[model samples]
Target: MVAGLVLGDAWLWVAVEWSPPAYAPFYARGGFDALTATLLVAALVKAALLWLILRAPAPGPLDRRAKALRRLLYLAVAYNLVLWYAFALLPDAVDAAFQLALWTGIDVLYLLVIRWRSRMLRAAAGAMLAVELAGMVNELLDELDLRELGSGGVVGLGLTLGGVAATVITVVGQRRDGRWSRGTQAAGWLSAIVCALAIPLDILFGRISSGSLAFPVMIDAVGLVITVWHAATARELPAEGRPAELPPARQRVIRVAVAAAAVLPIIALIQPEQTPHLTYTGWSMDCYDRPSFGDLKPEERDAAFLCRARSTEGGVPPVFPDSLSDQQILAYGRALCRTEDRDERKTILTRAGSARPAWGVDPWDLVYVCPEIIGATYPELLRSTKETEAANAAYIAEKNARCRDPWPRTKGVVQASANYFLFVDGDTGYLVHDPGDEAADEVAEQATDKVYDDSALIGVAGSAVLIGHFEDVVDLCLTVKAFRTPPPQRTAGWDEVNEVPIVSRSGRLTVPEMGEGGDVGAGAPMPNLAIAGKGRYRLRVHVRVDDAGEEQHLVVVYPGASRKRLRLKP
Candidate 1:
């Protein structure tokens, strides 16, 4: 009984933990509370039933009437066991309803024919045997994947199979000797064998934790020991004598005790939990205990999810391939995002010194796909200030010698002005049309068309002369760039140094319109005199209109990083 109590409590704990979300309503309504209460009641009831069996004098060899009575006893016990298993293991409400109805209906039939004991026993035995066989077959079909057997079916199958074995063994023992003592020995052996087999199979199946099975197994084993003890002490009677019944007072006491046991479980079922959330019988603790992410505190759950997002394998562009595992990607991504290296920032810039798609991909993509590359391309990012600057020199040289050219470079832009904008990539000049002005649109079209007409300008492969709204088109250029010339200098006003605003967010150079009277000195040459070859320069200079209706030079020279010392003009 002590062993039974411990096992039962453990099983109840596990069942509550593994209970599914769908069973939340039931839990709120005290379904699990009822199950726990009933398991205790069942232990008590079974002990009393066994004591009654043991105390009765052994009946003489069975006449048809005695055989029928023994069969009825087996069926009644089997029916109860099957229902108990159903309630314990099945998560679905429908399955529980079916099993409950079956159990109650059988009991009702048994009561109807109670006066005609032989007929009632025969009828009940047939019904229970048929039920057990059907359940066994269903389980077999489901295990083979030929049918969909749910949680209820699984528990019902195990219980019925074990009950059938016990019943058959008892019947055989009774046939050999009419003594009820022999039947107790049969029960003991059957219980031992069934429970031993059941534990291993439950583990192999991987439904719930194997440890949880120990409770049910131990309880059955305890019952088996009790049966064996009773069998050893029982005495057989004369052939003509009937089995002895309990005294009236003892019978009345047993009846009252049984009633109390039944009532307790029913009351437990009706009583609702005070504070209920959705937690119920459907949750599986074993799932949370898996190797990669087990035993996580509530706070650690978000970290686990972050790890998953960075671990995507092949996609439309293969965001992050399976070449990297989730843990590796997550660790590297976090490292790069926290990096503080200036050179690491430049590694994201295009050969033209424009930062757009970082290293041929987005910054987010870098963190996910090739974090090691970010570290490799900019080693200073991961090092402390005291580390030698040349520490990565050899590694960089070795890698550059063998690494394939990271090609298909792309560039993007940001613009400050709402009017016109212009960008020159290689020999191709992109013009942004001010959609609100018909004259500006014509000028943009003419400028774009001139790119193809001029022979000196070497057109970059697949570079089309683009013309669209300043904000909608040229403002956000994510397309691949042909690495040729450095991107044009950008500024807010006249005074500045070489500033690297994130190129994706920095404005394209603003192109102001020419005055009504066009003439020499009408356009100003931006004074960053460094030119690429003899290609015809597609200038997009800002021109200031004077009162005379003539556009004059609006020269602006924003400063940049240079090694040479400059002579200051006084």
Candidate 2:
């Protein structure tokens, strides 16, 4: 009965007092919440009690009737034990490798406890049988199987296999040894029949806590022990005859009580938990815990999701954030977005230099990707202080060792204005059109294109050019240089390499009439790059996103002409 009380305590606490989200602090490692560990201490206490029971002196051999009643207790205990095991393995793996190890340990413990109690080879064999007798019946009730035990199927199967094998063997061996008892076999089968009530109760009770059922069973268990003791000790009890010797009404009452004690906890154990153990697997910019994700591989589901959590799954994303700290980066992004002036925006984003933490998003990419944080009420959110400056000085010393190189960048934007190669939809590279080519307008209408679309490396989706990105809002280092002839080819240090056509119809490398892109540079002063005249030209764009996510774009526009799309590397 004390053992029953201890087991009941865990269910009661979880059903009433335990809040999975409230305890998230204890379990959420990175984005993972290992809910199974929540009940570890309780399980240990239960194990301790069992250990004590195993060490305690054996009671005298039971007469047939007493042994039959005891078997019912064991039967209830068995059902509850398996239910507990199912629950223990309910939550999906937090760390797949670690969870697999835990699975082994927990399963072994389940078998050991059952076998130690039965102390027979048959008991050891029964440890593998899962509690499928009730589960198969679960299909008939609502047509839904034990999804409650999602992903825990293997664990349950192990238990059911072990339990059935051990029980069957134990019965056969005991009978062969001339020591088999009909009472014990009857108890197990009867307990199973009682356990089946879990289905109807599940339907009727709907979504209530297991406590509703467990507490009652605990009460019944206490009453049964007391009543049976009183009956046994009565001064004028019959020496033999089982229930035939007792009053009919009392016998019926005892039978009912035994049934109640056997079924209630088993029913309670299968009751749904308030928060099912969740395993999230997918590419998410935020956290998600659902059953669907359980179908994905551990690595796929466990990929670092940061930025912000979203309810809907995302499309092929530009980048999936891996870091947890985005507060400062968001503040910086908002500051850059205060005005539409492109230059000013760049100034604000890169103002902090090493003083600002990249937080896994380059400031340029933030202007497009994290557009939600732009145009905030608080623009100058986190201005640097004297202390921060000193700290940044220390930080830059280490950061610059690898980030000091410059490339042919946004140098003297010869013609930041694009009359011929206009700002198309998804394409952002230099483009040229024949006398009246409407390819730009036609493709622009297909998808919402971001100018600085940081979709990993630059990709050609329709007409838009997608670019790769830095880890965070790190400042870019650029050195734009013009070339009359094609620049010498350098094969290394480029993350993306693509070529786009730049048309100069009247033969002059001056700012052309670039159609309004409705983007950041709308109100900004234009900078012009002049390094050519007349005829067609091609801009070979070489991009580098460093280890820390800082970006550098090398633009070398030389005299050339091509209508075909060309992409060498990205």
Candidate 3:
């Protein structure tokens, strides 16, 4: 009877876990319809097998064992189906924990039903009972309040030791118990073996991971086979004056109960895995309402990109609190794009540009406004920004260090265009460069001995601020990008540029962090005066360094330069 019950449960677990239909409302909603149908069909097959087992002959009216077996079979069937259904409805992590608990519950019940038999079986059952109860308790405790008995912990270690001990004792006891049938002795030993194997398998596969189903079901199947073999061939024991059958009326009640147990689970199988009327809340709804993420929808892809951008902060990518839907995420991206304070422009462009052709969203869709600056979908653009910023940062660091030390002068000619030129030494500092063009009509000058003082430079459309540092007469120059006209006003054909002198000086300029796109310091890659463009023009800056006893003064030489061209296009 115990064997049949364990076998039935084993069958229940295999049927439900192998390829059972998914319940509704999973990440892929209704994705398990076919599998759900498969589970229903499997249930029908198991029900038929149970009927066959019931027809097998029994000796000496073993009513107690028979009753226990039927109840176990009913519980197994109901719980397996309920667990799968619940797993589909719950989050994956939550469902996994619940299934593990259910597995433990079923195992405990099995031990309780069969523990009264042999001394060896009782010992094995007691050990298992302790393990299961302890596991449950540990799971309920908080990590800070009390350490959980994880697979590697003391409680799990103890269970493993206990399982081994039980297996050894069972085998030794069976060898000594000469009067018991070999089959019965073997049965006790085999059950102990299953108990011993359970600890390692649980540890290896994890308590609720998918593969965990393999060992427990295997143990139950082995138990079932042994039970069937014992029932088929073993000699009958003394009747002990127990009635061969229950009283006639009581017999009828037993029959009814058995039939109901067999039939109820089969009926329960017909419940729909998910209902159309089901309502979800919080993250569940988020997943449910998400539009399909397929290559056909460019807007949806952009939305996904936007969602990733907005969700990420301070270099961390956004986590899926719950999987967001296509439409919902796209709506979020669209709303963000409309905001003026939005600083994800480079991030959007780079991510879009790097996307492969297989991805439906066109990079052009995100950066059509500034084609030249943004670079239309070139993957190289992604690394170019970083390389440029790194170069700038190294240049600033080196020049500042040089001014502090007044190091030996090293000169190298660096190329400069009308817009930007910086003397960059991988070893030294970075400086913005512009040689004096004789055509300029006005010149402004400043002299400062203290650090962090400003030098003003006049341009056609606007003026720029330059901060200088003096270390015992040596000078350092820093240019701050001045944006007098907003981005909207500065477009193609608009001639405006701020020129700084080409000289060896140590000065630092702060640019926005890369991909952050926010205001300076909010993120990297913020616009600097050096990055701005204008028509061909030049300005000459001369610096005279003189030493005081303990301090230094830097006098700026603003030689007249030209605004020969009205505009330069970038």
Residue-wise C-alpha lDDT for candidate 1, range 284-312, written one tens digit per residue: 23323221222344455334433333322
Better of 1 and 2 by lDDT: 2
Best by TM-score: 3
Better of 1 and 2 by TM-score: 2
Tens digits of lDDT, candidate 2, 1-570: 234235443443343223333433333333222223323323333333233222222235555544444444343333333334445564433223333343343333334322233455534443433333333232223233325433355654544444444344433433343322333334334434433443454454423432233333333232223222212222112222222244676446546544544554554445334433222223432444432222334344222222221122555322222121233434554554455566665465355342222333443333332334531432222222444455544544443343332443433324232112222342333322222324544433322343354343333333232333343432333333456666665547787667765554444332123234232111222232324555666656666766656556555566676755466674
Each model's RMSD to truth, in Å? Answer: 22.2, 20.8, 18.2
TM-score of 3: 0.29
lDDT of residue 159 for candidate 2: 41
- Tell me the lDDT of model 3 at 494: 19
Best of the two (1, 3) by TM-score: 3
* Over 4 Å off, model 1: 1-47, 57-129, 137-248, 263-570
- Give TM-scores for every candidate, taking all chains together and pairing residue i with residue i: 0.24, 0.25, 0.29
Global Cα lDDT for candidate 3 = 0.35
Cand. 2 Cα-lDDT: 0.38
